[model samples]
Target chain A: MRVTYHAVYLFLAAMLSTTLFTALKLFGVSPNLFIIYIVFAGFYVSKTEAIWLGLVFGFVYDIIVGANVGLNGVLYMFACFLVVVSCENVIRRNNAVVTFIFTAVWTAVLEGINAIFGPVSGVWPAIRIIIVEIFYNGALAVILYLALKRIFERLYDNEKR
Target chain B: MRKLFGNRIFVLLLTITISVSVVLGVINATKTKSTFMGNVAMVVITPLSDACTWVGRKVSGFFGYFGDIDELREENEKLKSEKKELEAKIRKSEGTDRENKDLRALLELSEAYPSLELVSAEVISRSASNWYESFIIDKGTADGLKIGQGVISGENVLLGRISDLGSTWARVTVLTDSGHSVSAKVIRSGDLGIVEGDLSLSKDGQCRLSFISKNSDIVVGDYLETSGLGGVYPKGIEIGKVIEIKPEVQGISQYAIVETSAEIETISKVMIITNNPAESTAVGEE
Candidate 1:
């Protein structure tokens, strides 16, 4: 029995989301990991799949942590759609540096929009948080990309046999 | 135009999905039961959260044991000195015995309320995903804990409410959560306002108090306590201290920084305040 790409994607997404959540709690930080997952989805999954995943994750997030319902779902869906559509012109490459840069940019954009429209207080402090979080998550994305790329390549090679 | 419409199935599907989600979201926003889904989702995620907390605790415990011996000793010494100072103050107060007798009378000034039936519980789990802000307590419905019950630290500081209660466990939404807010008052001055948690502020182990009047005489180190206006929390429980106050810009209400009394990282025992004021009053009358 071979694991499909979709299955791998789902597993990775869940793993990344859970890991990010646990890590944040352990360290008392709250950066958006769903946005990072959405970025990863945009790069790996088809546009249709990415949209659905975005909506599902967003709805789940809203149900989990949102003060008011639908706020996070709406934002997440829009962010996923934007990332998927925008990445259409860019050549697909799975390099660590590239993934890091893309994740950082997307994370910043999502956080920036949330800062403006989300329920954050004290916008000036939020700006500083965004900068530090972008750097932290950017470094994490680079490490994650390299590790995942190796794993995927090995899986692909095993499938050839 | 026909070809464009035919080829836009993905776009069309996306539109339908977004619309349905928005409509569902809107319905959730309008109803009190919107929290139902959140509670259910928390139940589904509890096991994962438990595992993560277990791992996190072990890791922290391992490192903390090695790192904090000297610091702990220093803190112990300071606490000893402070205890001695407090003892001296107690001895110096000539009316201390009379004041002890008047303690219950002062509590009655806030309006006689029910004596709470508190069940102590330990935090057994914390959030495992970035999406939810929750922790699991060992006590649950079996322990007479109920949803909407208030959880308090040892110092009577408000922690959060029990959002989901199961047979053997319950999930608590910490006050430091982004969605949490409590009606609070300055304990010394009776100045009423709201204390809210900002995700960003949590980074520094603090929360924000907003909507205070510009003229309110709040200063650093003023004690904040629950106002009991919302019926969710009891009055006179210590919440935090005012660490910083920023005046509102151009006629806006003032905001203050609060360092929460309960250490978010090191909480071990918490009490569930199960009695509502009416029930508390009934018990008091009895």
Candidate 2:
């Protein structure tokens, strides 16, 4: 039930990324909202749930964006797994700063995977785009992280009850 | 065996690794067509994307009205003068046109090609990632579109070819995508070359014309057009103007950098030349 509710939000993220977010391009790149969502799921939800959501919705994102299937799914799965592990063992903190930092880092990872798997001819240009996206997604986290956290916590509590 | 199966992280990693391998294999095997899930997703999202774009345009136009009054006035004056000049030219050309038509009839020449049956489409959304230069249009197989059919701007500039299609939408791989290439010629010198996308140059909204002989007569300001060598795009469609020329790393031949004629970043509409006029089921035609 919880997964279904979050799945709707995931679909919305994918839809917006292709629609309105496309108009929000900064330096030829858009923020990977899926990365932000996956990180949130990792920190707030259980590791297993986060990984499942990442794999499923990541593929959905790729399909909607008209990209190769499984590329983003695997990358997103790995990101969720990494974040869950890091939260439990390394960071042990769930705050706006952590969300900001994780979002920035994961955006680079996901975009890096795309550059490697996609038909990128040059390295420097791809790097520049990745850097811009990191900053863009990180800044978005700083602004929306608290709200997102609150909403997810409330939903998770309801699911538990 | 039970202990390993119970290890949650281990099972998750194993599942992910297997899924990744399967995906890579499938991608390699079928790189041409969309998957079933992709088609389903397109069906669900295309309408929403179209609606969003419509709303976004209206909203932006509403906000822009206040700031555009002065620019509109200047443009209106310029358009008025241009309209007068065009009207005079049209009046002068009417007689010439009739004379030419008579001469053509006398010479027993049929029109070179039937009037093009073009299906106009609106760009619904762009590629979500910046790595690929592509956009989804609001027409597809139901509109008589096919893969490899040339998409063009209203001014007849070749945008790209239909790379993939669904029932209601299609994806166009623009001239600047790394995966795209077109056979082209210099209109002035008639030197033939292959115009293709390079990742580095695509960032600057440019493509490279390669395979020019070391001593080809191509120059920086030369214009490029489709050579009709490839069956995909028809001949004489304007591509772009050459901006620069550079030597290949092997020092054997040089390539010219061509700036696309159409400002691709801002284009909102395109016309796809239907494969066959008879095949075109006009959207609202009986």
Q: iRMS for all predictions?
A: 5.0, 2.7
lDDT of 2 by residue, B195-267 (tens): 9998778766899999998999988899998887866766777899999999989999999999999667556
Q: For each candidate, what's the DockQ?
A: 0.23, 0.44
lDDT of 1 by residue, B1-286 (tens): 3443454754575476457556655674454332556655655555555555556655655565556779967876887777977755654673454334334333442233337666777676555333235666777777887778888765566788887666667878778766688999997777889998787776556888989998788889999988777888766667899999998676767999999887666564677887784355322233
DockQ of 2: 0.44
Candidate 2's displacement at residue B76, Å, is: 14
Best of the candidates, DockQ: 2
Writing each residue's lDDT as its tens digit, candidate 1 over A66-110 gives 344565566566667656555664545556776788778877776
The worst-scoring run of ten residues by lDDT in candidate 1 chain B lies at B104-113
* lDDT at B202, model 1: 69
lDDT top scorer: 2
Residues A17-91 of candidate 2: C-alpha lDDT, one tens digit per residue: 776776666766778788888887787677777678888878887786666777787778877877876776677
Candidate 1 similarity to native, TM-score: 0.70
